[model samples]
Target: MDGLYEQFRIALHQVWQRRWLAMAVAWCVAFAGWVAIALLPNSYEAKAKLFVAFDNMVPTAAAASQNPQNDIMRLKQTLTSNENLTRVVRRTDLNKLVTSDAALGGVVAGLRQRIAVVAQPDSLFEITATSSFAGLSNAENARTSAAIVQQLVELVTSGQLAGDPQRTQQSLTFLDEELRRREQQLQEAEQRRMEFEQRYMGMLPGTGTVADRMAAARTELAQLEQTIVAARSAVNAMRGQLAATPATVPIPGAENAYAGTASGQLAGLEVQLSQYLGRGFTEQHPDVISLRSQIARLGPQAAQERSRGSAAGNGIPNPSHVSLRAMMSEREAQLAAAESRRAQLQADLAQLGQRDSAQPGAAAEQARLTRDYDVLRQQYDRLLADREQLRLRSDMQTQASAMVVRVVEAPRAPSGPTSPNRPLFLTIVLVLAIGAGIAAAFLKGQLQTTFPTANRLASVTGLPVLGAVGEVVGRAERTRRRQRLVWLVGSGGALAASYAALMAAEMLQRGPVA
Candidate 1:
């Protein structure tokens, strides 16, 4: 370790001996760095700010229906699109200085990167722009910034308003179509109701609609009345026929029940005996015996009466027994005819009642259809109202839902160029050059590994140092040494080269002012 330390010290001393050369290289490199920075053109940066705010209208159900958030999102996308940027480029005439098309692309890209379009926290947007112009004035920078932000605002605003006409037109068209359809539906419904009324006219009572159960009942009553009328007519006609017909016409060979026969004489004798008994005659009295004898004598008469006649004239006519029998037969015939007619009328009435029972279902369906049409019509009307309100809003005098940009901090002409920070550049150059110079000197010394110190030579070769000697020279010896070009020439040339490099570095640092 000691040996290595001694070797390093010797190496450092050798580098010091050539210190001029190291200093020269460092100074040259640094000066070159300064000159490079000086020759490059200076650039200026300009920035501007834009403040944005969305519509602050009070939110109503109407506003919610419009979906204003969608509008805001669309505004964001429109502001960022290439078309808007291109418009900004044209308005700013950025192409004048940015000559080449490809170069212009790069400039535009750079502009986009530098510029910012950020929404402020809980507010609208903040737009910013930065540009580099070699020697632009304060006014010019301000104008550029203002122009860019303003153009961006216009681009976004125009885009926002772009779809208005088409949207409005489409709305109008839709409303018109809906109105027409609704009108048609209402008319058709009315026509259908009228047709239904006409078809069943008087079949349904008041309201002429079977929608009312009472009306249906009344209609049934009307049909029943017609049936009753027919029934009554048939009964009257049967009664008239029974009244006109003869009552006692014989039923031909069944004549034992007829008048003027021995059965009549015998029926008379029995009536007399019943009367005498009612007068309190005794069963064995003479009057009773005479009645009995008369009854006996009429026995043949009774048989004759049974065969062909009815008893007559014994103070009471025999009640026309044949006529009564014939009248009973006629009455039975009349009853049969009336009953058949009543059955037919009853059948017709049942059919009418069945029809009346089904009426309510049909009427209810029609009512449901009517209600649906009415509701749809109302919806269409409300939509129309909303559209009209929007149209009015567009026409009305009011502030636009847009932000105003203000220049909070105006740009100023810089006192010194922002670029080419001289001191910083110089420091960077000095540090790098010093590092390179030190490294080169150390590396050269290591690679050469010259035996500059007596100790180094002694240690490496194990040689003994006999004595350290300093040269003792006379004038002649010095002159002879100088005459030998090898040593003297090399030393002189090295010093001259070092001095020349220093002068050149100084000259390069301070060029012509212009």
Candidate 2:
């Protein structure tokens, strides 16, 4: 512990004795460092914050285009693109210095590093531009930073707004041309269908495909055959009932001829005809016409025999038998009509089948035509929808969804240099200079051959030294030493004062003088 204290004391004395050298070195280092720091170009930075909101007012088309992240990504790319940087160079005072293509390219390359675009959540963008351009004043660089940021934003905004309309118009034109082509195709298909039907009108069915009509006709033909069979069975049942019942009931005092009169038979036939009419059989029905013919044939005979049939109340008409015969006639007529319909339907189906077999490619050709028409129709409809959407987008206001950038904070010239941190750096340099000077003085003291302490001398020489004595000086010498001390103190104070001055100068600076 004693040795350490002794060494510390020796070091303090060494520093004090070389104080003048330390002051000179400190002054030189501080001044040189301050000059170098001052000579470095100041980097002025401008910053802007923007808010982007998308409001696509078009109907039903916003869903596919509502991606804010993609829009923000595009904004980032556009902001730093070469085209935007080129525009920035032209719009700012930087253009004056960059006359040649090489100069412009170099400036644009430098601008790439200087500009920064940061995208934040909730559609916020932070745009920062820095300028450390040479041959320009710090104030000019500060202004240029703001101008470049503004120009970049303007370029991006104008680009998004302007390019959309032209592209939309082009799309609309293309869709229109496609629609016309599709329309022409649709007409040609219709013409082909018409000509095909006309050429094979006798064989091919109208209003439906041959197969569909054939299937339908076959189904109906089967149903008609079933109806005909059922009707024939019903007519046979009625005939059996008529066979069981006699046409007339005989009485005790009448002749057999007198029992069955012509009037009564005619009346029975007329009654049957009336029943057929009441049952919704039209006058044009075969049964109804046949009954009318029979009535006509029997009318004159019945007129002559009416009195004889009245006189003989011997035979009376059986109503049940008459009714059965009338019903049988109606059923037989229906069966005949069904048979006729079945024959006609069979003939039509045969013709369709034969036509299809003869042509062999009719169904395939029709199928291909239908398929082509359907495909073209679907494509035309899709293009129509797309065209409508494009029209909506084209009709948007000048500053529409894509041009939604809002200047939350406009870019402005910086009041101070962003880099170099001058005041702090100046203080660091001052401290380092002072430290270097102290180190130099300490090294010089160590280089000397003399030793201030007896122990130090003894340790070095490996000899025994008893002690050391202090120097006794006259009052005048002491005064002289005091004067030297004051000079040394003043020199150090001046160095400190210069450091303070540099710091003050740095702090007082708002920006470069214009």
Candidate 3:
């Protein structure tokens, strides 16, 4: 602590010795600092605030998915997009103002860092912009801020759906197209249903729906009846031929021969049948004798057939009866079937006539088709009605689009310069000057080869500083008195110089009196 005090004392003495140089340096530094502050560009800042409102009146159930806060955020992003910014730049003519001077342009570029956009906790925003200029007026700053707000309003509200006029028209156009398509499809489907109904009018599978089937059956039955008539004519022709034929006798020359032929023919039949003895004929013994007598009578015809055996190609002795009976039976069955078919045809034809008379007329069918078509047309009309209603809603919306923002509190010109903070600058400069003064005192001490204490001198030179007196007390006392006088004079001179500079600056700004 002692050594430090001694060092300080020595530094103070050195500085006092070079007081003129020290003062010159201090004045130079002060002037330089003042010049730097004067050359700095002047700057001004402007700020504005806006309050957002959500004015939709629809009920929550109708728009359950909507979030008003999210909508506001979306709007905020749109306001800041490049597209909106470009519009803002053009409308405010910012480029013109910013580029008019190089310094202003630099200030504009720096504004990106200085400008602030803040959203308050409760859905409000504060927008601020800063501009720097050499000699800007307060009115100019106010005008710039007002213009920026106007441009922002335009950029934000021009295309917010509520302001667009074309949306309603587009919706109407789309609805018209869809309505047309539905109408066409309905017409085609109706036409196809009518054609199908006409082609299959009465040929349906159910018995109750068989009008066409009955007609077809009647026609088929008529054709078969004609065929039966042809068959009956053939039967009559055969009967006529049978009636014109005469019976032949095997023994025609003598009556006795005839009778003997009959008896002999019967006996031959009896003798041929006797080849099989009846095991159960005991009770019918006389009946068997009578059958023998009858067979003996037809034996002559058997003998006649035997005489003509060479002409009989089939070995069966009596094929005439079997072939004639089979042909007769087949003709009878065919005739019966034809008659049955005719009866069935008559019944079916009667049923068809009844059904035809019972069915509704073409007028009624057409009315039914028209009724169905009207129903579909009504449905389509209802849909169109709904769409038209929505279109009216859209049209109304277009007429009442969202409002653009207007200023609640317009910007006003500030009274004071925002830049060149004088109090802060003065404080900083005074502190720096004191530090420089201390440095000068220390540097002077080092350059003068001065020793702070006797011990230091002895230690440095390896010699005793005999009777080293501190600061040469008598000289110091005189210097102290001299220093008091010098400080008074020097401070007075600095005050005069500063007052002169201030007067010059003020004069330059005010100009000479008229």
Off by over 4 Å in 2: 56-66, 156-403, 511-514
Q: Model 1 over residues 329-351: C-alpha lDDT tens digits?
A: 66556656655655654554455
What lDDT is reached at residue 452 by model 2?
Answer: 86
Q: Once superposed on the true structure, which residue ranges of model 3 sit more than 4 Å away at CA?
A: 60-115, 133-409, 452-455, 468-514
TM-score of each: 0.38, 0.51, 0.41
Report lDDT per candidate.
0.57, 0.77, 0.56
- RMSD of candidate 1 to the truth, in angstroms, is 21.7
Q: Which stretches of candidate 1 lie over 4 Å from their true place?
A: 1-11, 39-41, 60-95, 98-110, 118-127, 133-407, 411-422, 464-467, 470-514
| Native-referenced Cα lDDT, model 2 | 0.77
**What is the Cα-based lDDT of residue 69 in candidate 2?**
77
Residue-by-residue lDDT tens digits, candidate 2, 13-126: 998888888888898899899999988788999988888887765545544544567656756865676766777788898887797999899999998998888988778888
C-alpha RMSD for every candidate: 21.7, 14.3, 23.3
Question: Better model by TM-score, 1 or 3?
Answer: 3
TM-score of 1: 0.38
